[model samples]
Target: MAVALQTLVAEAERYLASAKIHDYCPNGLQVEGRAQVRRIVSGVTASQALLDAAVEADADLILVHHGYFWKGENPCITGMKRRRLSTLLSHDISLLAFHLPLDVHPEVGNNVQLARLLDITVEGPLDPTDARVVGLLGSLPEPLSPRDFARRVHEALGREPLLVEGEQMIRRVGWCTGGGQGYIDQAIAAGVDLFISGEASEQTFHSARENGISFIAAGHHATERYGVQALGDYLARRFAVEHLFIDCPNPV
Candidate 1:
Protein backbone atom coordinates (compact mmCIF):
# COMPACT_ATOMS: atom_id res chain seq x y z
CA MET A 1 0.00 0.00 0.00
CA ALA A 2 1.13 3.57 -0.60
CA VAL A 3 0.50 6.74 1.40
CA ALA A 4 0.98 10.30 0.27
CA LEU A 5 4.34 11.70 1.44
CA GLN A 6 2.68 14.80 2.85
CA THR A 7 0.19 12.76 4.85
CA LEU A 8 2.92 10.59 6.34
CA VAL A 9 5.02 13.59 7.31
CA ALA A 10 2.05 15.37 8.87
CA GLU A 11 1.08 12.34 10.92
CA ALA A 12 4.65 11.81 12.10
CA GLU A 13 5.08 15.43 13.12
CA ARG A 14 1.75 15.45 14.95
CA TYR A 15 2.48 12.17 16.71
CA LEU A 16 5.88 13.37 17.91
CA ALA A 17 4.88 16.99 18.60
CA SER A 18 8.00 17.99 16.71
CA ALA A 19 7.16 21.69 16.44
CA LYS A 20 6.99 22.07 20.23
CA ILE A 21 10.45 20.66 20.89
CA HIS A 22 13.69 22.66 20.54
CA ASP A 23 16.26 20.43 18.86
CA TYR A 24 19.72 20.81 17.40
CA CYS A 25 18.29 20.01 14.00
CA PRO A 26 14.92 20.50 12.33
CA ASN A 27 12.49 17.64 12.91
CA GLY A 28 10.12 15.94 10.45
CA LEU A 29 10.69 16.04 6.68
CA GLN A 30 14.09 17.41 5.67
CA VAL A 31 14.14 16.35 2.00
CA GLU A 32 11.36 16.06 -0.57
CA GLY A 33 10.97 12.88 -2.54
CA ARG A 34 8.28 11.06 -4.51
CA ALA A 35 4.68 12.09 -3.93
CA GLN A 36 3.73 8.70 -2.47
CA VAL A 37 5.64 6.45 -0.12
CA ARG A 38 5.12 2.69 -0.29
CA ARG A 39 8.05 1.48 1.76
CA ILE A 40 9.91 3.14 4.70
CA VAL A 41 13.45 2.54 5.85
CA SER A 42 14.30 3.50 9.39
CA GLY A 43 17.69 3.74 11.08
CA VAL A 44 19.49 5.40 13.95
CA THR A 45 21.42 7.73 11.64
CA ALA A 46 21.15 8.85 8.02
CA SER A 47 24.69 8.04 6.97
CA GLN A 48 25.90 7.22 3.48
CA ALA A 49 25.85 3.56 4.34
CA LEU A 50 22.19 3.70 5.34
CA LEU A 51 21.31 5.63 2.19
CA ASP A 52 23.10 3.06 0.08
CA ALA A 53 21.29 0.25 1.82
CA ALA A 54 17.95 2.00 1.43
CA VAL A 55 18.64 2.44 -2.25
CA GLU A 56 19.37 -1.25 -2.49
CA ALA A 57 16.10 -1.96 -0.69
CA ASP A 58 14.20 0.43 -3.00
CA ALA A 59 12.77 2.37 -0.08
CA ASP A 60 10.40 5.18 -0.85
CA LEU A 61 11.21 7.08 2.35
CA ILE A 62 14.03 7.05 4.90
CA LEU A 63 13.34 7.76 8.56
CA VAL A 64 16.23 8.41 10.90
CA HIS A 65 17.08 9.83 14.30
CA HIS A 66 19.91 11.99 12.92
CA GLY A 67 19.67 14.30 9.89
CA TYR A 68 21.43 17.32 8.38
CA PHE A 69 21.11 21.11 8.89
CA TRP A 70 22.22 21.41 12.47
CA LYS A 71 22.20 24.58 14.59
CA GLY A 72 25.94 25.31 14.26
CA GLU A 73 27.19 23.15 11.41
CA ASN A 74 28.52 24.76 8.25
CA PRO A 75 25.76 25.88 5.92
CA CYS A 76 27.43 24.82 2.71
CA ILE A 77 26.32 21.40 1.53
CA THR A 78 29.67 20.13 0.22
CA GLY A 79 31.75 16.97 0.48
CA MET A 80 30.09 14.33 2.68
CA LYS A 81 26.97 16.39 3.17
CA ARG A 82 26.68 16.98 -0.56
CA ARG A 83 27.00 13.30 -1.29
CA ARG A 84 24.35 12.40 1.30
CA LEU A 85 21.86 14.97 0.07
CA SER A 86 22.61 14.06 -3.55
CA THR A 87 21.84 10.42 -2.81
CA LEU A 88 18.47 11.30 -1.33
CA LEU A 89 17.67 13.69 -4.16
CA SER A 90 18.85 11.38 -6.93
CA HIS A 91 16.93 8.44 -5.56
CA ASP A 92 13.86 10.54 -4.74
CA ILE A 93 13.78 9.13 -1.20
CA SER A 94 12.38 11.52 1.36
CA LEU A 95 14.41 12.01 4.55
CA LEU A 96 12.41 12.36 7.75
CA ALA A 97 14.38 12.72 10.94
CA PHE A 98 13.45 13.23 14.58
CA HIS A 99 16.08 13.99 17.21
CA LEU A 100 14.95 15.14 20.64
CA PRO A 101 11.38 14.29 19.75
CA LEU A 102 12.34 10.67 19.26
CA ASP A 103 14.26 10.67 22.52
CA VAL A 104 11.59 12.28 24.69
CA HIS A 105 8.48 10.52 23.43
CA PRO A 106 6.75 8.66 26.27
CA GLU A 107 5.83 5.60 24.22
CA VAL A 108 8.54 5.08 21.60
CA GLY A 109 11.33 7.23 23.02
CA ASN A 110 14.81 5.82 23.14
CA ASN A 111 14.91 6.03 26.92
CA VAL A 112 11.51 4.37 27.39
CA GLN A 113 12.18 1.59 24.87
CA LEU A 114 15.55 0.95 26.48
CA ALA A 115 13.97 0.67 29.90
CA ARG A 116 11.57 -1.91 28.54
CA LEU A 117 14.40 -3.87 27.00
CA LEU A 118 16.30 -3.89 30.32
CA ASP A 119 13.21 -4.58 32.49
CA ILE A 120 13.38 -1.38 34.50
CA THR A 121 10.22 -0.07 36.13
CA VAL A 122 10.11 3.62 35.34
CA GLU A 123 9.50 6.04 38.15
CA GLY A 124 9.58 9.35 36.34
CA PRO A 125 11.80 11.82 34.50
CA LEU A 126 15.33 12.13 35.78
CA ASP A 127 14.84 15.82 36.34
CA PRO A 128 11.27 16.60 37.27
CA THR A 129 11.63 20.38 37.06
CA ASP A 130 13.36 20.35 33.68
CA ALA A 131 11.27 19.44 30.66
CA ARG A 132 14.21 19.66 28.26
CA VAL A 133 16.09 16.71 29.66
CA VAL A 134 14.64 13.40 28.57
CA GLY A 135 16.67 11.16 30.84
CA LEU A 136 14.65 8.82 33.03
CA LEU A 137 14.75 7.44 36.56
CA GLY A 138 13.72 3.87 37.18
CA SER A 139 14.38 0.85 39.39
CA LEU A 140 15.06 -2.79 38.85
CA PRO A 141 12.62 -5.30 40.31
CA GLU A 142 15.55 -6.55 42.36
CA PRO A 143 18.90 -5.04 43.17
CA LEU A 144 21.80 -6.32 41.09
CA SER A 145 25.48 -5.69 41.57
CA PRO A 146 27.03 -3.17 39.24
CA ARG A 147 28.81 -5.90 37.31
CA ASP A 148 25.66 -7.94 37.03
CA PHE A 149 23.75 -4.96 35.72
CA ALA A 150 26.53 -4.39 33.20
CA ARG A 151 26.18 -7.98 32.09
CA ARG A 152 22.45 -7.54 31.63
CA VAL A 153 23.02 -4.43 29.50
CA HIS A 154 25.63 -6.24 27.48
CA GLU A 155 23.32 -9.17 26.86
CA ALA A 156 20.43 -6.94 25.87
CA LEU A 157 22.36 -4.55 23.60
CA GLY A 158 24.78 -7.19 22.27
CA ARG A 159 27.73 -5.00 23.27
CA GLU A 160 29.91 -4.96 26.33
CA PRO A 161 29.34 -1.66 28.09
CA LEU A 162 31.99 0.30 29.93
CA LEU A 163 31.18 0.06 33.64
CA VAL A 164 32.36 2.19 36.53
CA GLU A 165 31.59 0.09 39.61
CA GLY A 166 30.47 1.84 42.72
CA GLU A 167 30.39 0.54 46.26
CA GLN A 168 26.63 0.03 46.47
CA MET A 169 24.30 -2.52 44.89
CA ILE A 170 22.18 -1.16 42.04
CA ARG A 171 18.44 -0.83 42.60
CA ARG A 172 17.47 2.65 41.52
CA VAL A 173 18.64 3.45 37.98
CA GLY A 174 18.78 6.39 35.63
CA TRP A 175 19.56 6.50 31.90
CA CYS A 176 19.53 8.53 28.71
CA THR A 177 20.16 7.05 25.29
CA GLY A 178 22.71 8.44 22.78
CA GLY A 179 25.18 11.16 23.78
CA GLY A 180 23.52 11.91 27.09
CA GLN A 181 26.38 11.43 29.52
CA GLY A 182 26.10 15.09 30.39
CA TYR A 183 23.05 14.13 32.43
CA ILE A 184 25.07 12.08 34.88
CA ASP A 185 25.09 14.87 37.40
CA GLN A 186 21.35 15.28 37.03
CA ALA A 187 20.93 11.57 37.61
CA ILE A 188 23.22 11.83 40.62
CA ALA A 189 21.13 14.66 42.02
CA ALA A 190 18.07 12.43 41.55
CA GLY A 191 19.67 9.95 43.98
CA VAL A 192 19.86 7.02 41.63
CA ASP A 193 22.16 4.19 42.71
CA LEU A 194 23.44 3.92 39.13
CA PHE A 195 23.38 5.89 35.91
CA ILE A 196 23.65 4.69 32.32
CA SER A 197 24.26 6.68 29.13
CA GLY A 198 25.43 5.93 25.61
CA GLU A 199 28.62 7.99 25.75
CA ALA A 200 30.67 9.29 28.68
CA SER A 201 32.90 12.32 29.12
CA GLU A 202 36.06 12.70 31.21
CA GLN A 203 34.23 14.57 33.93
CA THR A 204 31.59 11.83 34.05
CA PHE A 205 34.10 9.43 35.57
CA HIS A 206 35.08 11.86 38.32
CA SER A 207 31.45 12.66 39.04
CA ALA A 208 30.48 9.00 39.32
CA ARG A 209 33.49 8.22 41.49
CA GLU A 210 33.08 11.21 43.77
CA ASN A 211 29.37 10.64 44.11
CA GLY A 212 29.87 6.92 44.72
CA ILE A 213 27.35 5.81 42.11
CA SER A 214 27.75 3.19 39.44
CA PHE A 215 27.98 4.33 35.80
CA ILE A 216 27.78 2.55 32.48
CA ALA A 217 28.61 3.84 28.98
CA ALA A 218 26.88 1.60 26.54
CA GLY A 219 27.76 2.06 22.88
CA HIS A 220 25.91 5.07 21.44
CA HIS A 221 24.60 3.22 18.40
CA ALA A 222 23.60 0.17 20.39
CA THR A 223 21.62 2.12 22.96
CA GLU A 224 19.65 4.13 20.40
CA ARG A 225 18.73 1.35 17.96
CA TYR A 226 15.28 0.54 19.30
CA GLY A 227 13.32 3.80 19.18
CA VAL A 228 13.39 4.34 15.40
CA GLN A 229 12.43 0.72 14.80
CA ALA A 230 9.47 1.04 17.14
CA LEU A 231 8.41 4.29 15.48
CA GLY A 232 8.69 2.68 12.05
CA ASP A 233 6.56 -0.25 13.18
CA TYR A 234 3.95 2.13 14.52
CA LEU A 235 3.86 4.02 11.24
CA ALA A 236 3.67 0.79 9.30
CA ARG A 237 0.71 -0.38 11.33
CA ARG A 238 -0.98 3.00 11.08
CA PHE A 239 -0.62 3.53 7.32
CA ALA A 240 -0.43 -0.09 6.14
CA VAL A 241 2.90 0.68 4.43
CA GLU A 242 5.94 -1.58 4.57
CA HIS A 243 8.68 -0.63 7.05
CA LEU A 244 12.24 -1.90 7.22
CA PHE A 245 14.79 -1.13 9.96
CA ILE A 246 18.38 -1.37 8.84
CA ASP A 247 21.14 -1.52 11.43
CA CYS A 248 24.56 -0.57 10.07
CA PRO A 249 26.59 -1.75 13.01
CA ASN A 250 28.76 0.90 14.68
CA PRO A 251 31.24 -0.25 17.33
CA VAL A 252 31.16 3.19 18.93
Candidate 2:
Protein backbone atom coordinates (compact mmCIF):
# COMPACT_ATOMS: atom_id res chain seq x y z
CA MET A 1 0.00 0.00 0.00
CA ALA A 2 1.18 3.50 -0.85
CA VAL A 3 0.79 6.58 1.34
CA ALA A 4 1.54 10.12 0.32
CA LEU A 5 4.96 11.28 1.44
CA GLN A 6 3.49 14.45 2.92
CA THR A 7 0.90 12.45 4.81
CA LEU A 8 3.54 10.11 6.21
CA VAL A 9 5.76 12.96 7.31
CA ALA A 10 2.88 14.82 8.90
CA GLU A 11 1.70 11.71 10.70
CA ALA A 12 5.18 11.03 12.05
CA GLU A 13 5.70 14.58 13.20
CA ARG A 14 2.32 14.54 14.90
CA TYR A 15 2.77 11.13 16.51
CA LEU A 16 6.19 12.07 17.85
CA ALA A 17 5.15 15.61 18.80
CA SER A 18 8.37 16.72 17.13
CA ALA A 19 7.77 20.44 17.19
CA LYS A 20 7.30 20.51 20.99
CA ILE A 21 10.85 19.45 21.68
CA HIS A 22 14.11 21.18 20.80
CA ASP A 23 16.72 18.86 19.24
CA TYR A 24 20.19 18.98 17.74
CA CYS A 25 18.93 17.90 14.28
CA PRO A 26 15.63 18.58 12.57
CA ASN A 27 12.99 15.88 12.97
CA GLY A 28 10.51 14.47 10.44
CA LEU A 29 11.48 14.46 6.72
CA GLN A 30 15.12 15.35 6.20
CA VAL A 31 15.13 14.59 2.47
CA GLU A 32 12.24 14.62 0.03
CA GLY A 33 11.88 11.63 -2.27
CA ARG A 34 8.91 10.18 -4.16
CA ALA A 35 5.53 11.74 -3.45
CA GLN A 36 4.09 8.37 -2.46
CA VAL A 37 5.78 5.93 -0.08
CA ARG A 38 5.02 2.22 -0.25
CA ARG A 39 7.91 0.55 1.49
CA ILE A 40 10.14 1.95 4.25
CA VAL A 41 13.45 0.86 5.71
CA SER A 42 14.22 1.92 9.27
CA GLY A 43 17.46 1.74 11.21
CA VAL A 44 19.36 3.29 14.11
CA THR A 45 21.46 5.47 11.88
CA ALA A 46 21.36 6.59 8.26
CA SER A 47 24.88 5.45 7.45
CA GLN A 48 26.10 4.44 4.01
CA ALA A 49 25.45 0.77 4.74
CA LEU A 50 21.84 1.46 5.84
CA LEU A 51 21.21 3.63 2.79
CA ASP A 52 22.63 0.90 0.57
CA ALA A 53 20.36 -1.61 2.27
CA ALA A 54 17.36 0.66 1.75
CA VAL A 55 18.30 1.03 -1.88
CA GLU A 56 18.61 -2.73 -2.24
CA ALA A 57 15.24 -3.18 -0.55
CA ASP A 58 13.67 -0.72 -3.00
CA ALA A 59 12.51 1.38 -0.09
CA ASP A 60 10.61 4.56 -0.82
CA LEU A 61 11.60 6.11 2.52
CA ILE A 62 14.31 5.67 5.14
CA LEU A 63 13.45 6.25 8.80
CA VAL A 64 16.27 6.55 11.26
CA HIS A 65 17.17 7.70 14.78
CA HIS A 66 20.29 9.49 13.65
CA GLY A 67 20.17 11.76 10.55
CA TYR A 68 22.43 14.43 9.04
CA PHE A 69 22.62 18.21 9.54
CA TRP A 70 23.37 18.39 13.23
CA LYS A 71 23.99 21.65 15.02
CA GLY A 72 27.68 22.81 14.89
CA GLU A 73 28.65 20.06 12.45
CA ASN A 74 30.58 21.18 9.34
CA PRO A 75 27.91 22.13 6.83
CA CYS A 76 30.09 21.38 3.83
CA ILE A 77 28.86 18.54 1.61
CA THR A 78 32.26 16.93 1.07
CA GLY A 79 33.69 13.45 1.15
CA MET A 80 31.51 11.16 3.32
CA LYS A 81 28.61 13.56 3.63
CA ARG A 82 28.71 14.25 -0.09
CA ARG A 83 28.73 10.56 -0.94
CA ARG A 84 25.87 9.78 1.45
CA LEU A 85 23.66 12.53 0.09
CA SER A 86 24.54 11.56 -3.44
CA THR A 87 23.38 8.02 -2.81
CA LEU A 88 20.05 9.12 -1.29
CA LEU A 89 19.39 11.69 -4.01
CA SER A 90 20.33 9.26 -6.75
CA HIS A 91 17.94 6.64 -5.40
CA ASP A 92 15.14 9.14 -4.71
CA ILE A 93 14.69 7.75 -1.19
CA SER A 94 13.43 10.06 1.53
CA LEU A 95 15.23 10.33 4.86
CA LEU A 96 13.39 10.97 8.13
CA ALA A 97 15.24 11.20 11.45
CA PHE A 98 14.09 11.67 15.02
CA HIS A 99 16.62 12.08 17.80
CA LEU A 100 15.67 13.21 21.32
CA PRO A 101 11.98 12.91 20.60
CA LEU A 102 12.41 9.25 19.81
CA ASP A 103 14.41 8.67 22.99
CA VAL A 104 11.84 10.23 25.31
CA HIS A 105 8.58 8.92 23.91
CA PRO A 106 6.66 7.05 26.65
CA GLU A 107 5.61 3.92 24.75
CA VAL A 108 8.23 3.28 22.05
CA GLY A 109 11.16 5.36 23.30
CA ASN A 110 14.60 3.82 23.56
CA ASN A 111 14.77 3.93 27.36
CA VAL A 112 11.26 2.51 27.77
CA GLN A 113 11.85 -0.25 25.22
CA LEU A 114 15.16 -1.10 26.84
CA ALA A 115 13.45 -1.23 30.21
CA ARG A 116 10.73 -3.50 28.86
CA LEU A 117 13.35 -5.81 27.35
CA LEU A 118 15.14 -6.03 30.67
CA ASP A 119 11.97 -6.33 32.79
CA ILE A 120 12.43 -3.05 34.62
CA THR A 121 9.62 -1.28 36.45
CA VAL A 122 9.95 2.41 35.72
CA GLU A 123 9.57 4.65 38.78
CA GLY A 124 10.00 8.08 37.25
CA PRO A 125 12.29 10.26 35.18
CA LEU A 126 15.89 10.43 36.36
CA ASP A 127 15.35 14.13 36.63
CA PRO A 128 11.82 14.21 37.91
CA THR A 129 11.60 18.01 37.74
CA ASP A 130 12.78 18.33 34.17
CA ALA A 131 10.14 17.66 31.56
CA ARG A 132 12.73 17.22 28.82
CA VAL A 133 14.99 14.82 30.67
CA VAL A 134 15.76 11.74 28.55
CA GLY A 135 17.10 9.44 31.25
CA LEU A 136 14.78 7.46 33.51
CA LEU A 137 14.87 5.89 36.96
CA GLY A 138 13.49 2.40 37.53
CA SER A 139 13.93 -0.86 39.37
CA LEU A 140 14.47 -4.45 38.31
CA PRO A 141 11.79 -6.99 39.10
CA GLU A 142 14.31 -8.61 41.41
CA PRO A 143 17.72 -7.49 42.61
CA LEU A 144 20.63 -9.15 40.90
CA SER A 145 24.35 -9.21 41.50
CA PRO A 146 26.55 -7.05 39.28
CA ARG A 147 27.72 -10.09 37.34
CA ASP A 148 24.21 -11.38 36.88
CA PHE A 149 23.00 -7.97 35.72
CA ALA A 150 25.84 -7.79 33.21
CA ARG A 151 24.98 -11.27 31.97
CA ARG A 152 21.33 -10.30 31.61
CA VAL A 153 22.28 -7.22 29.59
CA HIS A 154 24.45 -9.35 27.32
CA GLU A 155 21.67 -11.86 26.84
CA ALA A 156 19.11 -9.23 25.94
CA LEU A 157 21.25 -7.00 23.73
CA GLY A 158 23.48 -9.71 22.20
CA ARG A 159 26.49 -7.70 23.36
CA GLU A 160 28.51 -7.76 26.54
CA PRO A 161 28.35 -4.43 28.31
CA LEU A 162 31.38 -2.87 29.98
CA LEU A 163 30.52 -3.28 33.66
CA VAL A 164 31.60 -1.11 36.59
CA GLU A 165 30.64 -3.03 39.65
CA GLY A 166 29.28 -1.27 42.69
CA GLU A 167 26.90 -3.03 45.05
CA GLN A 168 26.60 -6.80 45.29
CA MET A 169 22.92 -6.56 44.46
CA ILE A 170 21.42 -3.85 42.32
CA ARG A 171 17.78 -2.88 42.71
CA ARG A 172 17.00 0.69 41.76
CA VAL A 173 18.55 1.66 38.42
CA GLY A 174 18.64 4.48 35.96
CA TRP A 175 19.24 4.45 32.21
CA CYS A 176 19.34 6.41 28.99
CA THR A 177 20.37 5.19 25.54
CA GLY A 178 23.00 6.57 23.12
CA GLY A 179 25.92 8.54 24.52
CA GLY A 180 24.15 9.27 27.78
CA GLN A 181 26.97 8.66 30.22
CA GLY A 182 26.75 12.29 31.21
CA TYR A 183 23.46 11.53 32.90
CA ILE A 184 25.28 9.34 35.39
CA ASP A 185 25.50 12.32 37.69
CA GLN A 186 21.76 12.67 37.67
CA ALA A 187 21.31 8.99 38.37
CA ILE A 188 23.79 9.19 41.21
CA ALA A 189 21.99 12.15 42.64
CA ALA A 190 18.78 10.19 42.36
CA GLY A 191 20.36 7.45 44.50
CA VAL A 192 20.11 4.67 41.96
CA ASP A 193 22.18 1.57 42.66
CA LEU A 194 23.04 1.15 38.98
CA PHE A 195 23.20 3.42 35.96
CA ILE A 196 23.11 2.21 32.36
CA SER A 197 23.98 4.15 29.24
CA GLY A 198 25.16 3.56 25.67
CA GLU A 199 28.68 5.08 25.81
CA ALA A 200 31.20 5.53 28.59
CA SER A 201 33.43 8.53 29.07
CA GLU A 202 36.83 8.75 30.82
CA GLN A 203 35.26 10.34 33.88
CA THR A 204 32.40 7.87 33.98
CA PHE A 205 34.57 5.35 35.84
CA HIS A 206 35.53 7.87 38.51
CA SER A 207 31.96 9.01 38.92
CA ALA A 208 30.66 5.47 39.20
CA ARG A 209 33.36 4.39 41.64
CA GLU A 210 33.38 7.50 43.75
CA ASN A 211 29.59 7.61 43.94
CA GLY A 212 29.26 3.87 44.54
CA ILE A 213 26.89 3.41 41.63
CA SER A 214 27.23 0.50 39.25
CA PHE A 215 27.78 1.52 35.64
CA ILE A 216 27.17 -0.38 32.41
CA ALA A 217 28.27 0.82 29.00
CA ALA A 218 26.03 -1.10 26.70
CA GLY A 219 26.83 -0.63 23.02
CA HIS A 220 25.30 2.63 21.78
CA HIS A 221 24.06 0.99 18.61
CA ALA A 222 22.67 -1.98 20.49
CA THR A 223 20.79 0.06 23.07
CA GLU A 224 19.27 2.40 20.49
CA ARG A 225 18.25 -0.30 18.00
CA TYR A 226 14.78 -0.63 19.52
CA GLY A 227 13.30 2.86 19.13
CA VAL A 228 13.47 3.10 15.36
CA GLN A 229 12.16 -0.42 14.96
CA ALA A 230 9.29 0.31 17.35
CA LEU A 231 8.44 3.48 15.48
CA GLY A 232 8.64 1.66 12.16
CA ASP A 233 6.37 -1.08 13.40
CA TYR A 234 3.86 1.44 14.66
CA LEU A 235 3.88 3.24 11.32
CA ALA A 236 3.53 0.02 9.40
CA ARG A 237 0.52 -1.04 11.49
CA ARG A 238 -1.10 2.37 11.40
CA PHE A 239 -0.65 3.11 7.71
CA ALA A 240 -0.86 -0.44 6.32
CA VAL A 241 2.51 -0.01 4.63
CA GLU A 242 5.54 -2.28 4.68
CA HIS A 243 8.41 -1.52 7.07
CA LEU A 244 11.81 -3.18 7.25
CA PHE A 245 14.42 -2.68 9.96
CA ILE A 246 17.93 -3.03 8.55
CA ASP A 247 20.65 -3.71 11.07
CA CYS A 248 23.98 -2.15 10.14
CA PRO A 249 25.93 -3.06 13.23
CA ASN A 250 28.35 -0.65 14.88
CA PRO A 251 30.28 -1.52 18.02
CA VAL A 252 30.33 2.10 19.13
Best by TM-score: 1
Please list the C-alpha lDDT of all candidates, in the order they appear.
0.95, 0.94
Tens digit per residue, CA lDDT, model 1, 1-252: 999999999999999999999988999999999999999999999999999999999999999998889999999989999999999999999999999999999999999999999999999999999998889999999999999999999999999999999999999999999999999989999999999999999999999999999999998999999999999999999999999999999988
Counting clashing residue pairs in each candidate, in order, gives 0, 0
Cα lDDT of model 2 by residue, 194-252, tens digit: 99999999999999999888999998999999999999999998899999999998999
Model 2 clash pairs are: none
Q: How far is candidate 2 from the true structure (C-alpha RMSD, Å)?
A: 0.8
Candidate 2, residue 18: the lDDT equals 91
TM-score of each prediction: 0.99, 0.98
Clashing pairs in 1: none
Give, for candidate 2, the lowest lDDT window spanning 10 residues.
124-133
